[model samples]
Target: MRSLIVTEFMSLDGVIDSPGGGSYPHAGWTFKDVQMDEAAYDIKGREQQEAGAMLIGRVSYDEFAPVWPTMEEFAEYNAMPKYVVSTTLTDPQWHNTTVLRSLDEVAELKQGEGGPILVHGSATLAQGLAAAGLVDRYHLLVFPLLLGGGRRLFATEVADKQRLTLAEHATYRNGVQLAVYDVLR
Candidate 1:
């Protein structure tokens, strides 16, 4: 079975919204507040290299589909098969993209042949997957500052508690920390 990994650029307060600048008032907080060095993004590069496929929510797919295909840095992601969870999305314009209607489809995808499937910037999808106990691991880049209010990584109303084991961790000079955890099954 393939592992489903959720990756996010999160804040100290667990806010995962608008890290790359969107409609949020505190948009672009990740680049603005943190004094990031090249090393701070090493994990991101490694994720791209290691990921066998990409999974995202409709919102994240909308955000990334138009841009990632044009960037050299995101070539790996562009080339990999991508699955977007959406009930409304009819046709996807991005290459190698497939629309999955529910989490059951995602679970089925996990059971199929593949390596680790990485989830990026799909906050709602990640939350759903976590709550459903479908997420196998998390790769979080925790920034030092807090936005006070925004969409968070963890949901408050999850039915059960998830136990995690720290697989790896690293602190960058910019005060950004990489925390990799494996969800205990």
Candidate 2:
């Protein structure tokens, strides 16, 4: 079975809102108010470049499709298989992408043979996968800041039950911290 890895840029307060630009009001609050370096950006860039596939929520897909595809650096992501989990989006403007309408579709995708299935900014999808017991691993970048509001990466209901086993830890010269973990069932 292929490993489903969910990667998130989260705050200490568990806000996974927006880390990119001012597209989200709650976003940038954590990263801007605090002074923190972006650790292992190069390493992340390399990993992104080598990624085989990317899975994202509808909102995230809309936000990323227009920008990342235009970037010269994200060519690998553009060329690779991209899956978007959405109920409302009837047509995907992005090339090399497929929209998944049901949770079962996601499960079937995971059953297929492949490299790591990278999930980025799909909070709802991540939660659903977590609830369905589908997530195999988590690659989290916890920035040092707190945004009081935004779409949370972890569900409030799942706070007590879900436990993670740390498999790897790395910190860069920048304040950013990276931790990889597996969900302890």
Best of the candidates, TM-score: 1
lDDT accuracy of residue 127 in candidate 2 = 92
TM-score of candidate 2 versus the correct structure, residues matched by position: 0.89
For residues 26-119, write the lDDT of model 1, one tens digit per residue: 9999888888689889988998898999999999999998888999999999999999999999999999999999999999999999789999
lDDT of 1 at 185: 87
Q: Tell me the tens digit of each residue's lDDT in model 2 across 42-161.
A: 546755765678899898898899899889878788888999999998888888899999879888998898777889986899998888888888888877776778788889887447
**TM-score of each predicted structure versus truth:** 0.98, 0.89
Candidate 1 is scored at a TM of 0.98
Off by over 4 Å in 2: 29-38
Worst 10 residues of 2 by lDDT: 34-43
